[model samples]
Target: MQNKKNVTLLIIVAALGYFVDIYDLIVFNVVKKQSLQELGFTGDALKANEIFLFNLQMTGMLLGGLLWGIMGDKKGRVSVLFGSIFLYSLANILNAFVTDINQYAIMRFIAGIGLAGELGAGITLVAENMPKEKRGYGTMIIVTFGALGAVVAGMVGKTFGWQTTYIVGGGLGLTLLLMRAGAYESGMYQNLLHNSEIKRGNFFSLFKKWSLFLKYLACILIGLPIWFAIGVLINLSDRFALAHGLIEKIDIADSVMYAYLGLSVGDLASGLLSQYLKSRKKVIFVYLVLSVSLMFVYLFNTNVSVEYYKYMCFGIGFGTGYWALFVTIASEQFGTNIRSTVTNTVPNFVRGAVVPITLSFSSLSKTMGPINAAMWVGLCCLALAFLATLYIKDSFSKDLNYFEID
Candidate 1:
């Protein structure tokens, strides 16, 4: 009974931790226009600044992903949970007070660094500690709860305004810190810590071998479409709406909220479907196809009502809901020594992929227009994701108690 209690507590705390993470991560998107306008950015300036800040934030996550992943492996998962939350929470509190774009971008970068740790550490802990048979359910709960944070962010950003939303996100992270008091470190990680014979947290080791490099690359590639969809298709909903000649401007916040709500449902459904099908690759492939199909529908059907467009956003989000399984596969693919590193970095790399994805979209937009550029980029991302999926081995039932040798 006590054992079950510990597991339950971990899951709850991890879920809330991720909840705050998502809230902070998505809040900026929700409030970008209003906040930037308040800071004197408008028209093309506002759009340019938004993209810059967003890219900077993802850059921070890319760097922080490596930092925290190594720390999680070298220091401990619990350390990451505590340290990451503190950094991000403090950054967010300061974020509420920024007077200029430079300050805003810097704070967001710091917060990105902080947000980088939550999901990887939480998933690592949950995967290591839970019964192998039920780990998928555990991770699904974390992601589903985490994804709902975007929904909450949408509502909170809409209700409280941007500054207050930042304040609330910071407060939630600090509040979640209190719960970490009861959390325990993963035994698998502990075992690795005691065995000094095994080298741990070696980021460069991933590239030392062709096979290992390919596995890591494939893991990262399979997730590019998810970020491309969110960072491009939905994040630029206003621009797309303009391009489509809509009668009404689609509310970015509502589009984000509805899409995330769909994501939550899709994560739950995909997680369950993967369990039922007993094949992570198959489920991911199916969802990737769904995602591509939805992307085409979204790009081609511009004459639809605002309400219908929002529905399409929801469908796209749902189709991209294979994220939990993607991370789970990453965790399961490696040994205990490098699992945290791989698990943490894979998703962040995917998130960071938004930088190039956005850049490519921007360049292509110059030549083909925004909607057509997005269509081309979306197709390329989907194609790469499919190819990557072909190379990834199924890890649905793989054991986690092992090590990556030097």
Candidate 2:
């Protein structure tokens, strides 16, 4: 008999937490010019140097995920979520002050640990608390807010200079602190009296069941590589377009913003379709094939030419399908008891660990050409998503205790 207001507030706050983490993670590349120049890496090969920086920067997501996953499973998810938000938010505030590339890299790494933690912990909070009927829809709302945050950064950069962009990020991060202050721990979490074998908040008790860990291992290994490829494409796309003189800087910003909008739109559709569809497994099977199919058009073709609409279509198919189905559903795949163990797999480490993915895209762009390198990535990994989909099972609204027992 809880009121609707508190639950609504909790969801909103959690969404903001996710949004700002993505803001900091993405804004670096969005405003790459000033930051790179500020760092003092001056030469004909300055562009080459940027490739490494971007790769190093994005790896923070992995560190954050691993950090929060264990903490959320061990400690209270709410507390871990709070810590992740504070640390990463503060990191972005500090990011505005860095005078050099080395300092930015170090801060970004620290920010990443916090950033990754917030993502895993925040998603866990929403999934654990929301009702099953709205769970998939809830995932759409949260990630959509994150995409919106990226859109905000681009809009701000277009109007204001890049330096002020971090100031805005810092302000948003700080404002989120107010929103989170009122967030009460989930009532569901507070009630553990019904269970006998399990203690209310025992860290060691989670792993007392061994089979759960085995299942997690398979999901993590298969998922991380594909996420790595996706991240590479996103980080490189704007830079690739800018380098080729294919579009104006403003148009580049608009394209990225459009991608976010398209991604969020696709998410809404995925959520709606889930209710009418019986087999989420079957839905994902189609999504995987479509994602791979579109990757062919995305990688080999140009998003800048008269073919821009085709690229936009590719985004709708791939970006939306990735989070709406792959990442979003990953959190819901396992039971709440060990949800963190499994769902956090592809989000954090899947793309997080591969520092080389971004680097490879950058190198390929430098060596061959942006579109050609993209083709290589698409052809190499297009069918991989389908292969991974083969092993996936829907974990929708699982019975927590029963999932653990099985």
Candidate 3:
């Protein structure tokens, strides 16, 4: 029922969701130390707690993602996207008022729910609407805009305070709700409504399918562990940056800005990179290996000569190579009926399972040098990417039907 011109509006609304998603999450990572201290994490190694907090955020992302996936598939991606906007915005605003680490972590988990909702619904909306050849392009736009949100959060944190940053993120999330309400549902879903009976399925049937089951396993094996590290790092990076004085005294907004700028650059380049590579799996493969090696080198080479340079490289490479690339690959691997199902749920369960265990790993990293610990974790996770990449087929130039959920 919608024309190609409507596609323009789709990009704007969808990209706005992505933007808020990044804003909500990236601040935790960029200003981890300051936030932890503000909420009463004090010790010789306040930084260590960052890993646990990071786990909480990732866990939230995973859980939110799973629920959002099911809801989007059943209720319509637009409905879920709007739902995400409200949840994350309110949670962010509330996050500013929390007082203790326990409360902070709990609040973050709540916020993560909103974060999960937006990411799941927004991604599915873009993938469902875009032409097959350009799905990656649209996804890249979503990622880039979302990454830009991090930049905005970071800049705001640096200029004002983390609380102020959350206020902006909250306001942005609130403003978008009305915009999202005006958006349309999937053309595919509309067709289903007009020409077919609603064959309403329950939650259990959604996951019982063998295809979704295997994809869930893959998400656990390859996706969750790496994401565990990513979540921890994002929540804790301000401390790391300040460690070398590239950032001095964890000015929350500035640290966030540094991270956001890095991710935005990576999103743009990786989007182009994934488009040109003609093979998402292979590009992911190369970046996974390279990012690990680079993370290790960056960790030990603490020469003040290039402190900010190292932080910039780490943020950009992490965004371009490890973080955004895998999702693009996963989106195209599942068919339409189950694509949203796979994208949203698989990452969630995998993250949930991995987070607690990964917290132990983070503890070890915290005891060790943050960089050293990250390198060790990065290497292990990258190794998983290596194995998964071998099994993941290229989907860009292929027909969607060629790759079903399994």
Candidate 4:
């Protein structure tokens, strides 16, 4: 009974932690126009500054990914859970009072660093603690609940104004810190805690071997389509709507809400399908194909209604909903000594990929126009994701009670 209770507590805390993570991670995008407009940004200035802040936050995640991943493996997952939330919560609260874009950008970068640790550490812990047969469901629950945070951000941003929305996100993170106190470290990590002989948390080790490097690179590549769809297609829904010849304005918040709603459902379905088929690679492949199909549909259909475009946003989001499984695969592929590092870094690297993805999209837009550029970029991401999925070994049923060694 105590064991079950512990599992329940872990799941609850991890889910809520990720919930706050997703909320803080996306709330800025939801409130970008409103918040920036109040701070004196308008027209192209608003759009350009939004991209700048978004890239800055992602840059922080890129750096934080390496920092937290090493800490997770070297210190412990629970430490990351507590430390990341504290830093981000403080940054988020400060974000509420920022008067300038520079202040806002600085706060976001801090918050991004804090946000980078939660999902990866949480997923690593859950993957280690849960039974292998049921681990997919555990991660599915974490991700499904986490995805709804975007929906919550959308609704809350609409109702409370941007400042309060940020405050609420910060408050949620702080609250999760209390709940995190009861969560325990993984036994696998604990076993290695005193083993001074084993080299743990070595980030450079991942790149030193050709095989390990390819595996890590494949794990990162398989996730590119997801961020492209969310970071580019859905976030810029208004521009896409205009390009599609729709006279009515499409709300970016609503697009984010509906797309995340689909993402929640898709996470649940994909996780279950992975369990039933007993294969992560097959499900990812199917979803990548679905994502590609939806991307083309979204791009080629120029005369669609705003309602049709919103549904298309949902489709694209659903198609890219293999996020949890992808992270789970990363965790499963690695050993416990570096499991936290791999799990923690893989998702952030994927999130951080948004920097290059956005930069490429921006450069491509100059020659091909925004819509065509986005379509071309989407194709590239999907192609890479599909090819990478083929290269990664299937990890279902693999025992994880091991360690990475030199």
Instruction: Assess every candidate by TM-score.
Output: 0.99, 0.83, 0.83, 0.98
Sort the predicted structures by lDDT, highest score first. 1, 4, 3, 2
Q: Local error of candidate 3 at 263, Å?
A: 2.5
1-406 per-residue lDDT for model 3 (tens digits): 4567677688788888888877887667655666777867687557566666666877887778777776776667777877877887888888777777777788788887777766556666666677777777777777777767877776777677667777788888898887875688767655544533334213354467776555545544556434544444444555456555563443444534654566567657767877787657666666566555655554565564334543744453354333455565565665555556566665565556556545655577558866666656666766765676676567675455322321
| Residue pairs in candidate 4 whose N, alpha carbon or C atoms collide under 3 angstroms | none
Best of the two (2, 3) by lDDT: 3
Cα-based lDDT for every prediction: 0.92, 0.61, 0.64, 0.90
Instruction: Evaluate model 4: give its TM-score.
Output: 0.98
Find the candidate with the highest lDDT and give its number. Answer: 1
| lDDT of each residue in 115-232, candidate 4, tens digit only | 8999989999998888888889899999999999999999999898899999999999898788877989987888888688888899888888899999999999999999999889
Q: List candidate 2 segments past 4 Å from native.
A: 1-3, 42-45, 191-214, 217-230, 238-252, 302-319, 335-337, 362-370, 401-406
1 or 2: which has the higher TM-score?
1
Question: Please, what are the lDDT tens digits per residue for candidate 2 over residues 289-342?
Answer: 666555555554544562463355337434434464555566665555555544
* Residue 46 displacement in candidate 2 (angstroms): 3.1
